[model samples]
Target: ISIIYISSNHIAAASEQLSTTSQQVSQGASEQASSSEEISASMEQMVANIQNNTESAKQAEAIAFKSVEGIRKGYDSTTYALNSMKKIAEKVSIIGDIAFQTNILALNAAVEAARAGEHGKGFAVVAAEVRKLAERSRLAAEEIDRITHDGVKIADEAGRLLSEIVPEIEKTARLVQEIAAASMEQNAGADQINSAIQQLNQITQQNVAASEEMASGAEELNSQAQQLIDIVSFFNIGERETLKTLSNLRNDTRKIAQKTTTPNTEFWKSKRTKSKPKPAEGIDIKLSSNSDDTNYERF
Candidate 1:
């Protein structure tokens, strides 16, 4: 019984050690889990930031494209306006030519009418008015032509500038697209990091669970050792029926105790007992359970 009590004390000490180790491990795991969770959250936030930046870049590209398109349209309208102006100038020149020929015919009619005396006087005056009107029309047409040519030159220069601007804008848009692509890649990388952190957190949780299980097993072993010490008092006479079993039980417990002190030994060796083992000092051996059929450590 004294030996059993000693064994119980050893078990309790072992259990206390195990509990301490388990708590340390659990605390370590908790800290690691918290760190992993924080890292995961940070990675997720990075992914979100990347996504938002990519979206913003895309929007900027879209606006740039719209601006380029607007410039192109303006160029096209200017070209069209220049062409219409040229056509109008051509029509004005045609009108000027017709007026000049009408003025020449009126002068010839006036000369024929002048040979007819008083009738010639009124006819010559009418011809003079026709000549003055034709001269004014010719001057107006020349002025329109000059203005149209200048407008065409300005339109051409504007079109050239538009052409340069469009390509530059296109290049800018491509650059923006590349930036967006890079952002998307960063977002993907962040997601992968977050996933890895989550996996680490899960592993940390498993470690904590394993540590708790180990601690609990040690406490239960300590409790059973105390129970064995109490039951040893019931067999002071060392009954024949329980003598062998008790001997085996003592040998098994001793082996377990040895294992706690020894390294590189098999736990399976705890099941074996010598042919005859003495009862612990000052106590008779008794068995609550047989050692041969039952493996206490298996629990």
Candidate 2:
């Protein structure tokens, strides 16, 4: 019985400990589940941001492509305009040469008219007017040539700048495309991480459920152990009562035996006293009934 009691106590203690540990585990699992859910939510948000970044990168790439196209077209147009300016400048130079030749011819004609006399007076006035017109034309042609040359120079410089810009724009477009590709890859990675996190969250939820089950089982075990302890306590009380009753019975039997034997001892003493010989008070008594008896013996 003592062994049983000790065993019950140990089992109860172990059950209580197990219940406590199980409760702790359940609580921890619940916390972990909550944390995992939060992490999963954060991962989802990160994935969304990554996706947005990917889309933005794609849009930037498209804009870069469009810019490259526009730059290319502008460069081509500038080249064409530069060529046109060169042609215009050449034509203006030719016009200036023609004007100079006309002025020289007009001057010679004027000198020849002056050599003629009064009949050449009218011709001399006409030659002077022609020379003046030729001089004006030459001046105007020179001015036009100068303006065309300046225009050509400006066009050439613009074309050169456009040529430089086109390559840089192309480089920018390429870089933007790479950025878009990287963003897409990063977005994909984020999605995968989010998925993993979701799976982890699910596992954590399972753990929480399992832990709760374990805790419940532990609690049930603890309750059973408590009932067993109660049963053991009842048995212990019964065993103690049995021992006490046996001790009391033994004591009562001993007392009864003592009470019953005490009267027997007194009755035997009275019988011996009644059987004892009485002695006369004034006579001297001598006992010689047997040779071995020399003196009277006390009963």
Candidate 3:
């Protein structure tokens, strides 16, 4: 009887402590669920922002590609212009050579006319004028050749600079493409993480609900333990028949000590939280049926 009383008392106290711990676990689970939900929302927003940034990077990459194409065309045009200027300079040099040949022929004619004396003196003046015209033509051709050469140099430099720019723009485009790809990958990773967090939050909520139900079960168990302590006094060490009868009635309890059992109208209610917990489903706490046992045979 003393052992039964001690075990019953310990069970009841442990049940109460279990109920308190379960409530704390439920509350902590609820907070964890709420926090998980908030983190999921924030992660969703971050994914959206990353999508926007990825789109922006794609646009920039496209623009860079266009710039590269445009520069490539310009470079080709500059190279063509440089080649054309070089050809023009060559033609001008040819014209200068022709003028020099004409001047040399005119000088030879003047010398021959001088050798012919009085008859060739009239042709001397014409030869001298021819030489002068040829010299002036050679000077004009030289000036044109110099201008064309300078133009060729400028065009070549432009082509070279444009070639440099093309590589740079192409490099920039590649970098932008890489950035866009990385952002998309990051968005995918974030989406997967957010999904996992959502699942975890759901599991946490279920755990919180289970913990609440467990607390209710522990509360009911505590009530039954206290009631079992009530009937322990009937245990005896007398005649075998009487002891057998008591053994047959072993551990059976009545709904006695109603005054001592403080009924919790809102058993799951907490001062910190106003939310009402759902009923403890699947935990059957059977109470003694209301009946007046008039005969001693029932005892």
Candidate 4:
């Protein structure tokens, strides 16, 4: 009975401790689940931001490509215009040469008219007018030549600038493409992280469920321990009743020994023997009932 009492106390204390520990574990698991969920949400947001960045990078790369293409086209047009200006300059030079030759021819005609005397006076006047026209043509050609030369120089400068700009634009496009690729990689990594976080959240939820089960088991164990304690109390009460019965039997034996002539040892022994069987039977029945209750609780 003492052993049973000690064991019942131990079991009750252990069950209470287990219940406390299980509650703590359940609370911790729930907190972990909440934290995991928050982390998963944050990861999802990061993934979305990464996706947006990837898209923006792609758009920037496309714009860079278009700018590069436009630059190349502009460079080609500038080169063609430069060539055309050079051709115009050449034509203007040719016109200037022809104008100079015409001026020389007009001077020679004027000299010939001066040699032909009064009949040549009218031809000299015509020659003088032709010389004036030739001079004006030469002056106009010279001005055109000067303007064409300036145009050619300007065109060449524009072509050179365009040529320099083309390579820089291409480089920018390439850099933009690299940035886009990096952004895509980052986006993929973010998605992977998000997946991992989601998996962690799921595991955390499982842990919470397990912890809750453990807590429930602890509660059940505590109830079983309470029942065992009640059984132990009953056993303690039975032990007290057996002690009182033994005390009463000893008093009766003393009275019987005083009244009888024979020895009281056999009587006391017989009564003790008979009383032991009844308590033993009662203890067995109680134990059997307790065992059945324990088995039922376990099931």
| Whole-model Cα lDDT of every candidate shown, in order | 0.76, 0.76, 0.81, 0.79
lDDT of 2 at 93: 80
Please tell me which predicted candidate would have the highest TM-score against the true structure: 2
After superposition, candidate 4 runs with Cα above 4 Å error: 235-299
Candidate 3: tens digits of C-alpha lDDT, residues 1-299? 54455578889999999999999999999899999999999999998999999899999999999999999999989999998998899899999999999999999999999999999998999999999999999999999998998898899889989988998999999999999999999989999998999899989989999999999999999999978776643343234444444443452223223323644543223312434443652222222344333322323
Summarize candidate 2's per-residue lDDT along 1-299 as a digit string, tens digits.
43455567778788778878888888898898888888888888888888888888889889988988998898889889889888887887888788888878888887888888777889888888888888888898888888888888888898899889888888988988898898889888888888888888888888888888887887788787777666554432344544555565577567556556567877567557745665631122232344232221210
Error of 4 at 3 (Å): 2.6
For residues 1-299, write the lDDT of model 1, one tens digit per residue: 44455566677787778878887888888788888888888888888888999899989889888888898899889889878877887887898798789779878878877897896888888888888887887788788878887887888788789888889998998898889888888888888888888899899889888887887887777677666655543444344534555676778678678777655444444434343445663343444564432333332
Give the distance in Å from residue 246's predicted Cα in candidate 1 to where it truly belongs: 24
Instruction: Give the distance in Å from residue 267's predicted Cα in candidate 3 to where it truly belongs.
Output: 46
The regions of model 2 sitting more than 4 angstroms off are: 237-299
Per-residue CA lDDT of model 4 for 1-299, tens digit only, reads 54456567788888888888888988998898898888888888888888888888889889988998888888888888888888888888888888888889889998999999987999989888888888888899889889888888888898899889888988988988898899889888888888888888888888888888887888888788778777656542455555555566677678666646656787677667655645343332145444445444553
Candidate 1 has which clashing residue pairs, if any? none
TM-score, model 1 to reference: 0.60
Cα deviation at 150, candidate 4, in Å, is 1.9
Candidate number with the higher lDDT (3 or 4): 3
Error of 1 at 117 (Å): 5.8
What local lDDT score does residue 272 receive in model 4, on the 0 to 100 scale? 74
